[model samples]
Structure formats: structure tokens, C-alpha cells
Target chain A: MKCNAETIGLMHKYLDGDITTEEEQQLKYHLEDCEACQEHFRELKRTLTLIQSAERFEAPANFTANVMKNLPTEKKQVKYLRWFKMHPMLTAAAVFFILMFTGVFFTWEQDNQLVVSKQENLIIEGDTVIVPEGEVVEGDLLVKNGNLIINGTVDGNVTLVNGKLIDDDPLDNRGLMASVGEINGEFESVDQTFDWILYKLKGFAKKVFSFE
Target chain B: MEQIIREKIILVKKGDQSAYEDLVSFYQNKIYQHCYRMLGNAHEAEDIAQEAFIRAYVNIHSFDEKRKFSSWLYRIATNLSIDRLRKRKPDYFLDAEVKGTDGLDMYSQLQSEGASLVEEVENNELQRYIHTKISELPPKYRSIIILRYLEEFSLKEISEILDIPIGTVKTRIHRGREALRKRLRHV
Candidate 1:
């Protein structure tokens, strides 16, 4: 029996136990007659047996204990979720209050720099705001975190926060139509978001009933 | 015993965490060996085996009752080992074997039952040579070969554990065997 291509394949199938009975018979006959195929089969067997006989290692003795110790319990997170599920309304109220508190603190902290209105006509010389002489300011003028030196006529209200007014238009409003009608101190208006909300609400109530 | 294991799995699924100890104890050594065979490093094998058990415990609810648990755990460990191999740099391919293989002693701590088997090769020197040679195969062939021969899994079991088709598994085993045979012939 001559070893052909199919017989060569048969040798592999024979090793893996995939050959038919007829194929096995044919391969065995060829192996018996052919010395080359015989050596090939031996080498293949040796290779496989070498790997199989390699050592199986043992895990450390503390392996099981360590795994058990590190097993994170699903119960604690589940219980926390169950509690939230049980009191949905309370949870919602808590979330709402938390959002509101954080919103206020964030706005207060972020509004740290000086914010001056009517920036077009104002000359900022360091921390002092100079309304240059003879320039008539049109809207309500406000200064934050700095001093106001009003050298010009403010046609509307004047407000300053955290600093005194260095000077104002000398004309008095009680006797005539003075250009600076309102020079309010630090206690005048709200600047932060939370304060803005309160100021708007109080203004609404004052207009509805409390005003003269 | 199978029913007891299934019950323990069910308890774990129901959030009874302590019942998982029995499952871990039963499969620890086998999982460690599977990882060791795939990775070729004992320390990584131990760590990955522990990770496999932890992942199984975490995902107990998703495990199907109809499927065998050991196959599932093997799949997890095999995937983890492959990931570890893929993350390795190209330079460490041969360097790791040189540095890390010194502590490996095949004969020192064998189980009594496995020590005297007829399949145990007689030459310890040849065993060490083939052990290093096995690491030279790519992860794909290395893995299928390990599952097929070292662990003695059926072709279908290898398919399930690797999530590949059975025909693919068969082809890879042949190629892996051919590659190993050629490597051994060179020496």
C-alpha cells in the first residue's frame, strides 16, 4: 500500500479519532508498509503527549478564602435601591432641595468679580469707576465691588455696592428735576441669582399692594 | 452533587452571598489550572482565577440554568487570559518566558493521583523544553491546543468555551498540533 495524500490526512484523523473504520484500516496498512509515515505518526504523538504531561499547578492555599473575602455583596446596594423605591416622593423632594441649594452656592461663588453696568461711558481706573465729566449716562447706572466717582450727570438711578460714592451730581432733586434721582447704598438691590429671585417676588408683591 | 451545585447557584442569584463559597471551593483549582495553561504564568493564573470567580458571583443572575456552570467559568477565565495576552507589548513575547519561567517546577508539587499516570512523560528535560516551546505559539493556537489536550476537553466543549464553531475548533487543533510538531522537530 502506497501512502498518498488521502492517507496522509488519514494519519491526522486517526490521531484525533475522526477516521472511519475503512479509513483507519487503510491508514494502518500504509503505516505498516511505509517507514516515513511511521516516523511522522511517532513525532506527532510525542508532541501531543509532551504537552499533556505538562504539570498542572495548584492554587495557593488561601485562594478560596481570598475570593470569598473579596466577594462584594449585592445586598447592600440592593437594599439601598429598595429603600429609594419605597419612598419615591421623599426622594424626589430631597433631590429638588439639593439641586436648589447647589444652584444658589454656585451662583454666589461664581459671581466674584466686579460687574459694572453702562460700561460704554465708564472709565475704570483700577478699582474706581469714573463717569467722565459732561457725559450724560442714559440707563440706570450700577457698580459692584468698586467705588463710584460720578463726575457726569446720571440721567437715571445710581447704585453702588461694597463701596462709597466718591462724588455725585450736585443738583438736588427735591427742588428741581435733578439728574441723579436715586443714590442708593449697599442695602439697595439684589445681585446674586437667589437674591434676584427674592427681589423679583418682593417687587411683585410691593407693586400689587404695598406701594403708595 | 449536581443538584446541590445548581441550588447554590440559585441561592447566589437570589442575593444569598454566602452560598457562593461552596461553588468557589469546588472549582478553584481547576480554574487556576485553566488560567495557568492559557497564560503560562503561575502568578497571573492565580489572580485571573480569582477574578473569574468574582465575576461569576457578580453575574450569577445572568447565567442560564440549562447550561453547565464549569463551561461558563472556563469561558470567563479564557477570555480574561486572552485579554491579558493582547495587552502585552511585542518586546515581551520571548523576554517574559526567560525571566518568569525559572520558578516553574513540574515535578515538585504534583497531585498524587496524576503523578503515576502512564501519560506522564519520562524525560523531565524534554518536558521543560516543550513547556517553553508551547509559549511560542500565538494565543489563538496556544489556547485551543491547551483546551483540547492539556485540559482534555472535547472538541464541542472547546467550541462552547471559546464561543467559536466546532469546525473552526477542529481546524485550529490540527494547525496547533502541526505547529508544535514542527517546533519539536527543529530541536
Candidate 2:
């Protein structure tokens, strides 16, 4: 087998002993007869040796010290990280998500009984219960197979199916309260009742405090 | 269980300055040689070598006990040198590997020693040419050439350092060397 430019090109790595056993054999077989490739191989080897043996420069007297002087403070931080490591964003986001999750969970736990009672009332009433504005129902709700009219707010889902509702935005009913058939009326404004109650409570609180 | 090496590693990792110094002293020559060969400059090589040791000192925790420590150190030095080459490419090719002021045949002057000197000078020039041509090769091939020639690392050592298959290292080295030789032939 004759060695060509391609084979001779590989001769540098070959001479450096970087060639594979198979490649070594192939190169060896080719070089056994191919004088030009063999010569190229030897030259390449000599070059690698001369290059490796060439004089090397040493670092300046204070090279390491200089590097140390400019060393990043992150060295201390990497070790610190090994001991306790977490990304700031991930940590903050984790805290936020945990707080959010826990907030929902705790609220569900505290107000669960009220929600249950409202659900029971709806089931028991089993018919349209007209709730006047500013009226508060302190029991669970269950609107069974019937329409609920909201002249005011029922503290829970006002379910209706094939029933008429005489309010503006009727699609606000969604989420964990889906057991109710449907809802009627724009109850978004119904949230103001809390402010109204706080107003009355403030008056009562003021009257009570005034006596003190 | 190479107790001496094991103890040295343990001491260095424990932040023992003396142990670290001992390790530095032991490998400084080879490390400098690696950087010098890669960068074709003594001063830069020396700085890179020193920085490599410092890095080793800081990252000793990541070193696996079963592997050779010098190989790891050499890897860092080589990478640093290559990075320097990339940053200073235009200036690097112009450095002082050429002949004297007269630009007389440097090869002949080097060859006065003997016919062997011819190959030696040629090889030196060839390897020097490799420094410039190497940048043109793929990074993987470039790394193999640097490791094999500049660091004189064995195929197995390179495989260990790079965590690649030894066969792959062989192929890349072979291919990379061929590419270099071809490139030099044209020059």
C-alpha cells in the first residue's frame, strides 16, 4: 500500500505515538516501502521533539502574588456554596410560591367549615333563594337544580342552569366552586359589601370605644 | 495506593500552603513547558502556569482521587494557553520563532550541528507552524494536538483528562496532525 498526502499528513500524530494500533500498522506497512512518507514521518517526529525541548519562560517574581491580589472574592463564595447553595431567584421564588401555596391552604383550612355550611344550605334550599343586596348568609350554599337570584350577594356560588339571571357579567363563576350549575349577575360589585360591613363595624367599634 | 501522592492531595485540599507549594514546585517545569509550547511565549506561559496552579489550589475539592493530578493541572494550563492564543491571535503568529535579524536560513544555522539537526529544525518549525495552523482546526482536533505534542500527554492520559473514548482521542489526534502537516506543506 502506498502512502499519499493524506497518509503523510497523519504521520505527525503517527510519529508522536498518537496513532491507533490499526493506524500504526497501516502507517508502518506503508512506510516500510514508502521512503518519502517515512522521511516525512521522521521529520515530523524531530519537529515535535525540538519544539517540546525548546526553552520555556518562567513567570515573573510576583506572578502568583499578583494573580492572588486580583483573585475574585468568589473563591470564598464557592466554598460557601458547597456548604449551602441555592440560586437567589430560585430561593426567592420558592419562598413566594410556598407562601402563596400555604396562604391558599391555610385559608381553605380556616374557612372550610363555612364553605361546607353554605354548600349544605344550597342543597337544602333546592330552589331560587333571592338574596337582597347587602345581605350576608353565614351558612354553606348548595343551589340544586334551581335558579338563584342575586338582588344581593350569596356568600357562595349562585348556581343556575337553564335559569334566568338579571345581571351584567355572568361568566365569573369558575374554579373550585364548579359544583354549582351556573351563575347569574355581575357579582364583582358585590365585593363592596365587605367595605360596607367594615363601615358599620367601625361605627359600632367607635361607639364601643367611645364608652371606654 | 501511592501514599505520597494521596497525602499530597489530602494536604493540598485541606489548604496546606506548604503541601500546595510542594505540588507547585514538582510540576512547575512541565506546566510552564506546556503553556510555553502552546502559546509560543515564555512569559505568558509562565504566567499561565502560575495561574493554573492557583486554580488547582482553589478547585482541589473537585479533583477525583483515582486520577493523576498532574494531568488535571496540565489540562487547565493548556486550556488557559489556548484561550490566550484566541485572544491574541494577530500578535501571536508574529512572535520570535523566525530566523535572526538578517532572516538568513534559520534552518541551515540550526542544521550545522548535523543532518539530524535538519529534521530537528524542520520539526521545530513545523510545530511552530502548527501553533498558527492549529487555530484553523476544529476545537476538538486542536485540543488533541495541543495535548499530544505540547503537553506530551499519552492517548490514555488524554482520554482520562477529556473523559472521551481513547479511540476517539487517537482518531482526532491522527486527523488533527494530518491536517496540520497538510497545512504546513502549503506554507
Measured by TM-score, the strongest candidate is 1
Candidate 2 error regions (>4 Å): A1-35, A61-212, B87-143, B179-187
How far residue A209's Cα lies from its native spot in candidate 2, in Å, is 87
Candidate achieving the largest DockQ: 1
What do the candidate models score in CA lDDT, each in turn? 0.75, 0.59
Q: lDDT of model 2 at residue B129?
A: 54
Q: Report interface Cα RMSD per prediction.
A: 2.8, 5.8
DockQ, in order, for the candidates? 0.36, 0.12
TM-score of chain B of each: 0.77, 0.66
* lDDT tens readout by residue for model 2, B1-187: 3678779888666655555656666677677766765665445666678778878878889999787888898778767876877787455343335422465343543445356446666556555455556556776787777677666778899987777899888778767765665665544
Worst 10 residues of 1 chain A by lDDT: A177-186
- Name the lDDT value of residue A43 in candidate 2: 58
